[model samples]
Target chain A: MKTARRNKLKMNAFAWMLLFPSLIFLILFTFYPVAGALKTSFYMADLSTPQPIYIGLDNYKGMMEDDVFWKVFTNNIWFAVGTVPTSILLALLMAVFANKIVRAKGLVRTAFFYPTLIPMIAIGNIWLFIYTPGYGMLSRFLANFGVGDINWLGTQSLVMIAMIIMVVWKEAGYFMLFYLAGLQNISQEMYESAEVDGVPKWKVFWRITFPLLMPTTLFVSIIALTNSFKLVDHLWIMTKGGPDNASNLLLYYVYEMAFKFWDQGMASALTTVMIALLLLIAAIQFFGLDRKIHYR
Target chain B: MTKKISYTLMYAMAIIWLIPLVWTFWTAFRPKKLALSPSITFDFTLANFSHVWQGAPFSTYYLNTLLVVVGIFTVQFLTATMAAFAFARIDFWGKQLVFVLFLAQIMIPADILIFPNYTTLRDLSLLDTKLGIMMPYLASAFGVFLLRQMFKTLPYELDEAARMEGCSLWQILWKIYVPLSRPAYISFGVVSVSYHWNNFLWPLIVTNSVENRLLTVGLAIFAQSFETGAQWSEVTAATIIVIIPLIIAYMLFQRQFMNSFIHSGIK
Candidate 1:
């Protein structure tokens, strides 16, 4: 009995020894920064205040009044709204298409998914040329059909549309992989029985496939949501949140404030907001959306 | 039939998807003067690729990116393995709470905490180093969690079987759990390697010098071709240079890559 107790103690100590490195790194990088960001948000840490003066609620107040913040926030919302469902729907469609056709399966899947493998910066560089007006690919192609040249990336009203189209192109394939997996998980017997019932292809998809794909959709939605928030790398290449902040995202704004403007307080404030929003999304996924994503 | 229409639609969409890539390849290979020209031409040259290659330190960027990706993933595998072994088999206090806390990394990914993490690296005097670019991601919660799940699914009798031969915990983990968890390792490995390979913002923010820059950031910086006259050829060449390795790898190992993504996602 004493030996068994001693063995347990030995195992306990061994476990801590194993976990020590991970614990230290997790603290320094993840937990500490999150806590540090929250604390820094309350101070006045810009150039005017050389010492990072403590000022409660002032930073938040300033953020509320910052027109740039609201503009970017609105842009971000519109970005999410524009990208999520469209990409999800397109992904589902592509997955079904890829699943159905064997002759062109590999080629079709590669065409859809190859873009997902390319880094966003490269995608930005490629699409920037594609969206350029006058002699650009999209414009020149449209000119073939009697359309006037439009600056896709330079114009304010049209930039969001351009970005959404590019993102859908970039991301739908990634989500399609998940939907394809979901489709495969549906038993062959289910499809065979559906065919025996004389159900149309679209009707079978609507009634059977779509509902069965809810769990995958929910999973893909979380990835897409977080991506919408974090995918500002392309903005650095294409717009820099430009044409007068029309394309600025929260994270990019945070970058401009912290690195460009050296406004640590505002940067921290924005970081805190991003962290909170992410947590809210995480909370919703875990608490709220989990209940709704029913599997067949 | 609906099936025929869907198949045709699929082919059309596939072609639409291929255009940007085709455009890039066409612009890349064609003579520089005809890059944005409104006429069809078959004249091709490799000058743009050679020009872009000479203009940028792509070799250094590739080296730096490869070093950090490998370095980060190597360290992650080590840390995740040890941590996962402990969480899965060893008796430890606050295991559940600690595991939950580790998940904070996932919720607030390193990409989102760019500023704070930059400051953290600066404080460590790690900025501008490959290690700096790698430091924030060395211990991945996702890896640990995935591996822990994999380890748990392993039969307990294997551990007992090894232990009966006077094997240490290391022996049990090495001989039993590690070998059995190859699929999970491969899944997490592909996910981790690809993520770090394509990661931009943190690396961009941390590493400033040419020697320290990764391919994505280097490509972005080298894109000054835009201000010059219709240098889209050179820029697209540079873009292709950065992406071709991954594209080629994908072409070679398509099934393995796709299955890794699918397995990782479902887990």
Candidate 2:
């Protein structure tokens, strides 16, 4: 029994030795920054004020009062609402067709999935050229309908819409893969029986396919939601959070505060807030997943 | 008739999806003078690619990107492997809680913690280096989680048999566990490589100089919105250049990429 205890202790030490590398990194990068950002959020600091003064919650107060903050917050909500559902719907549709289509199956899948592989910077840049006035593809296409002369990225009203459209185009293909996987999990026998039963294709999809894909939908929703928050790369190219802070999402707003403005205090505050929101989203995902295991 | 109509509709949608890419290619190769004519022309040129290639330090950018992606993966594969082995095989102290913290790290990715991570790298004086971009990302929580799950599935008898044959842990892992988990490794490697390759924001934040500039950042700078006649032509070329390798890779390994995405989601 003593030797067994010694062996167990030795095993623990060996395991820890193996885990040392990851543990060091996770503590420094993930755990330390989380704590550091939370601490820094309370201080008053910026590019000018390198030495931060401890001012409890002043940064948060300032953020709450800041009009741009409110604007960007609402804009992000609008962006998420605008983009996620549309992308998911398009993904479902694309998955249906991609899974079913006979001719050009490879072509269909490639067209839908390739954009997801492209960098957001390139996506934004390509779309930037596409939205260029007069000579741009979008302008030219609109001109064919005699509805030209809209400044896509310049106008506050149109900027979010334009960003949303571009993002949806970039993202729908990615979400389609998830839905496609979910579709495959569903037995082919069910579909065969559905065909024999003469139930309409639409009904078969809604009644049979959609219900079974709840888990994927839930999973994809979190990814889409988090992506809506985390995705600020395109903002750098497309609008830089816009003509007048119109297209700014929360992540870009944090970026603007921290990097562009060099307001360390405000950046920290914003970063902490984002960490909170991300945690909240993750909590929702875990709780939803938990319910599946325990209740149903 | 309905089936034909729907197939035609789906095919049309597919073509519509392909247009942006095709248009980018067309604009990229077309003669500089007629890039914006909207009138179809047979005229084309490789000069746009050449001009942009010369105009920016693209070769350095490519090298930097390749280094960062490969460097991050090499470290991640090793670290993730070690951590996963421990988690899967060992009854370590506080394993459950430690794993929960790792999961929390995943919920908020290293990318989002740019502000604090910048400071962390700054304190180390590693900013603007490829290592800075790769540092915080060195130990991937997602990777550790993925590999641990894969490791858990291997039969225990192989491990015991190897141990009986006087194999050390390294030998067992290298000779047995690693070979058996090739599918998982490929899936994770593909996902990680593509993610870091296309990664813009974190690398964008961390690196500043021409020496450390990545493809996406270099392209972002090169493709700035100056209203010159040759803007779209060159911009499309630069864009295409940035995406071409990934596009080629996707074309060759479409099945693997798609399978990785699927398995990653479901698993």
Candidate 3:
């Protein structure tokens, strides 16, 4: 009994020793920066000046009334509204089709997923060419059918749609992987049972497969939501929030504030708000959406 | 009838997916003047490829990217493995709390950290260096969580056997745990490499000049320089150059890569 206790103690010590380096790194990089950002949000820190002035919620107050901030926020909502459901639905459809078909499954999956492996910056560059007005692929293709060239990235109304198309194209394959996993996890026995009962394929999907895949859906939604927030990388390359800030998302706005305008305080405040929004969404997923879904 | 409909749908979907890629490939290979032509003609040439190779410092970009990626992965692997082992096998007080703190890092959107990380980098005098870009990504919460889950599935008897053979903790990790966790390592490595390879924003913010610029950032600069109008051929050439390695890697390890994404999802 004493030896067992000693062994356990030794194991615990070893574990701590193993974990120490990672813990230190995490503390320095993740926790420290987060805390610093939170703190700096309340202070006006000028790089040229030595001391930070305590602003006491002024930055947050100013952000509340900032038009560009609100514009970016609304644009993000519009972006999410446009992209999320389409990507999810397309992913689900692709997964179902790929799962049901036996022939050329690997090839089909590769074809779908190949675009995803390409860097977003590269995709942005390619799409920029495709979206260019007269001498680009998209315009030329349209002109062949007696249709005139339409400004894709230039128009306010169509720019978000253009971004959404690129986003969905880049992301559907990734989300489909989750759905594929979910589809595989659903036993063949369930489908067979549904068939034996004379249930149609549609009904089987609606009743059995869909409900069972709710956890996967929730998981994918969280990732997709987070991705929607984080996917401003392409916007930097393609739009630069241009045509009078039509394509600006919240994070891009934050980048502009900090990097372009050099308003560190306002940027930090904006970042805090973004963080809060993310947490709220994460909370909703964890508590609300996830709990309502019955898995297994 | 149903089978035919499904086949048709599948083929249609495949074609839709292939269009952009086919366009890209065509633009890359087409003669410079014919790149944006309305009609498809097979006047393929290597001019664009040679132009891109000669015009840009692509070799330097590739080397820098490799160094940053490998450096980040090496540090992250060591740190994550050690942390995961502790979380899985240790009975330390406050373990759960510390683990929760680490998990919280997963939700912290990396963009929010850019300014502070930049400031930190500036303070360290590490800006524009490969190490500067890699430093922030050296400890990955996702990796820690993943390897912890893998370690938990491992039987404790193996540890016991190693201990009986007078193996120290490091020896046991190297001998028993590390070898057993190959799949986990491969999956994590795939995800990590692809992420860092495609990563743009952090590298963009940190690296000021071409000396340290990664491929993604270099591609962005190349794209940005064509402000007046789209240069379809040159841009497509650059895009292909940047993506072909990753595409080839994916093709070679398609199954393993898919499995890695699946494993990441499950974790």
Compute DockQ for each candidate against the true complex.
Answer: 0.66, 0.64, 0.59
Candidate 1 or 3, higher DockQ?
1
Candidate 3: tens digits of C-alpha lDDT, residues B85-184: 8888778767878877786777885655787777778888999999999888888889988898888899999999988999977887778888899999
Residue ranges of candidate 1 with Cα displaced over 4 Å: A291-296
- lDDT for each candidate structure: 0.88, 0.86, 0.84
Residue A238, candidate 1: C-alpha displacement in angstroms: 0.7
Measured with C-alpha atoms, the lDDT of residue B217 in candidate 1 is 91
Per-chain TM-score, chain A, candidate 2: 0.95
Weakest ten-residue segment in model 2 chain B by summed lDDT? B221-230
- Candidate 3 positional error at B55, Å: 1.5
* CA lDDT, candidate 2, residue A161: 93
Q: In model 1, what are the clashing residue pairs, if there are any? A: none
Runs in model 2 deviating more than 4 A are: A289-296, B1-5, B228-230
Candidates sorted by DockQ, best first: 1, 2, 3
Worst 10 residues of 2 chain A by lDDT: A287-296
| lDDT of candidate 2 over A74-156, digit per residue (tens) | 99889999999999989988998899877788989999888888899888877887787767788888998999588888898
Q: How accurate is candidate 2 locally (lDDT)?
A: 0.86
Chain B superposition TM-score per model:
0.95, 0.95, 0.96
- TM-scores, all candidates, are 0.97, 0.97, 0.95
